[model samples]
Target: MIHPPDRPTELGPGGDNAIAHAMGVAADEWTLLILRYALQDGVRRTAQWQQVLPISSAVLASRLRRMTELGLFSPVEDEEGAAYHLTPRGAALWPVLVCIWAWEARWAEGHPLCLPRMRHLVCGHQFEPCMACRTCGGLVEPREVTGSFGPSGSWPRSAPNTTMRRRSSGSANLGPGFFPESRALIGNRWSAAMLGAAYLGAHRFSEFQRRLGAPATVIADRLRTFRSLGVLEVLGDADRTDRHHYRLTDKGRAFFPVVMSAIEWGQRWFLAPEGPAVVFRHRGSDHPFSVLLLCSACSRPLTGKEMTVD
Candidate 1:
């Protein structure tokens, strides 16, 4: 029998599982689109978000309220209406957003609108953000990082409540200039967990099933989606489905920064009794891996205040 936490921990923000907590709030398609519009277009009011996004007023209000309760957004009542601004915690998600933009711009196909150019104001040049180690000041990649789970990192703790309904395929109608592929991969809790498991050395289909505790059909569906997105490749005998070894493709490996940034954001905002749910270490420096987003043009560290998207 599948045993979840004692409480209904699906969408609520309080939890010891930091990664799960982070995903709970930020890893939804609506949340990502809202954040994009807010950060890039300086959208703050309810009417403003509605004008830019296709989301209903009730859903937008609900998301805003939840984000406010989670410390990501603070609501201010004004003469017109309530305007929500990103808190420091919310502002810290700049790197994650930038990483998503970078991945989608580079890998995703058939964008209906042009993706915005991210400019580093300090360097006065448009650049792609690169992930680097905070300790040794070196570049970080999927292979160079090692992860270990703490007490809170159990599959039960990490898995979202399965009772939560999967999103409809047509629900992601965020107009143009939005992240479709990035949202497809990271926006879903199960898909994010499965991808993370792959990075943590879960290669075979059985391994993914074992680690994620997802249903066989759910696992299969996500694996197929990953393969279709060019994020994973099946090795060994294709006919032997059970023994098929799944590995990350180059495009998949490039998504490491997005994961790292999310992990860092989670560890920073969500507190667990057993410390961080998952601890990552840089192999070359052998130090705790801290994600630093740097500009490709000037190699300088990036901040939300310093970046202008156009």
Candidate 2:
């Protein structure tokens, strides 16, 4: 069982696992898109989804089923066909999506997909964070977050038994020691692209490499990184030697939102006239960047200036 980060026991309203849960939900790209579409455009049958999203039928089914099991979506049956709607737990993801989008819009190159304006629900502001917060209010830097195995955990099967696990603390003692393995798993240009490709349903290594046009060595490196991080794993007895056909592990699946948020950030800020390098949306509101930042103890809005540095 995964020991979660330190969070208020009396949750206002959210899933049990929080970080772990969200990571699982957001781990894949299509899953986030499924949620985003439902949230933004309202519920539509799976067929409708197939048009806008290029994901394969098998992958879509898997994503929908996983999300349903996680309580992010509730099955709704109607004349058109069966569709899914966001639950409260899923709806809570908007802020995270929005924040990520805002970041991307600024830092990354963008195309028409990257809209000129994004509405901040909190302040009813139509400006970017740089202008809204940095110019007007102030800036809030992302806490260099870390992870750990927590009180009860086990090294993955592939991980070295004597692997050196590094411990990192948040600005405040926000959580347990962070597992550095997680970063080595995902922290790379190709790693994120791999996840993004998965979100778009490019499963095979050749497909990923062809679409991304990355070097074979780069692809192999990312795959190995994810494997060691326990994010991706070799599936059943089929093609163990090929090493091209792999799927996301439960751990990697949970980390989707973090990747999605990051992609959304890239999409908004980094997109050029061509198009977004990546795009992500909130599963609930399809609003992206809906989660709030608050104190673990007081649950108060934790601002950048408010944090006391160690």
Candidate 3:
């Protein structure tokens, strides 16, 4: 059965605190913004969030409280008391956030929402984002994936030192996009759940929990992780005080291909006798459909050894 990483039933990352896991959802939008801001500005204060974010004091406090509680951020010693900085978990999200940002600039009609102009770090070219396999020159395809939880048990825990083992799927050779580290992140339960939830339109915490039945702490942590990584956004609600809403940023939305690939894999392996647990639809036609990750060069279904990473 598909289960989230094991957790203690407590309110933190220490033991079997399931509640701690549930609280991670709040980290989605609001918390991620805080982390992203910290990455850019070095540190940030509660007041900065109040002025720039549409979040209410209560919700902001709640989100920050949860992050501090999870050790994702800590107050640094400064003249102004302390500013929020990235913890180990928060730092790990950098690549994920970058990936999401690139996805947005490339796919989402080039929407400008809040994203800064694109910066291609590797090539130093000013352009939109795109993901390529490090090993192969080809693009990543959905069906070509095979993955595991990776070395880390969770954010607070240390990851083991070893090569990732690939799980077989369709007959086609997998593509290069399923790089060792990237696959591990994508295969994670929280990442998958958050991505799946976004595709299902569960933007807010309450709604995500309602739809997925995930604990509050778990949802909160994953959201924070994703946010820190830049997959989700937390916008302050002018009308609501105690609660804030979450949304997949353009980067997060572009991650739809990753989710589509997962859904496709589930359909192949985990489908119940009754029917598919979910189905994707077209907005204009209202027609349900599934997406395929095909090769940009040959337009063929890419998989296994046939694929390479850029």
Scored by CA lDDT, what does every candidate get? 0.77, 0.44, 0.45
Which candidate number would show the highest TM-score if scored against the true structure?
1
lDDT of 3 by residue, 139-198 (tens): 443223332222212222211122122243222322211222233235344555556556
- Ranking of candidates on lDDT, top first: 1, 3, 2
Worst 10 residues of 1 by lDDT: 1-10
RMSD of 1: 4.8
Supply the global lDDT for candidate 1.
Answer: 0.77
Model 2 CA deviation exceeding 4 Å by range: 1-21, 110-116, 121-125, 129-139, 143-310
Q: What is the lDDT of residue 65 in candidate 2?
A: 70
Clashes of each: 0, 42, 47
- Which sections of candidate 3 miss by over 4 Å? 1-27, 108-114, 121-123, 132-139, 147-310
Clashing pairs in 1: none
lDDT of 1 by residue, 1-310 (tens): 1112111123233353778766665567677777877877779998998888877888888777766766767778888878898777777777888898888888988677767788998989999998888988888777999988876676667655432222466665544657778766876678889988988999998899888888999999999999999999988986899879899999999998888888777777766665567888998675798888889999998888788876
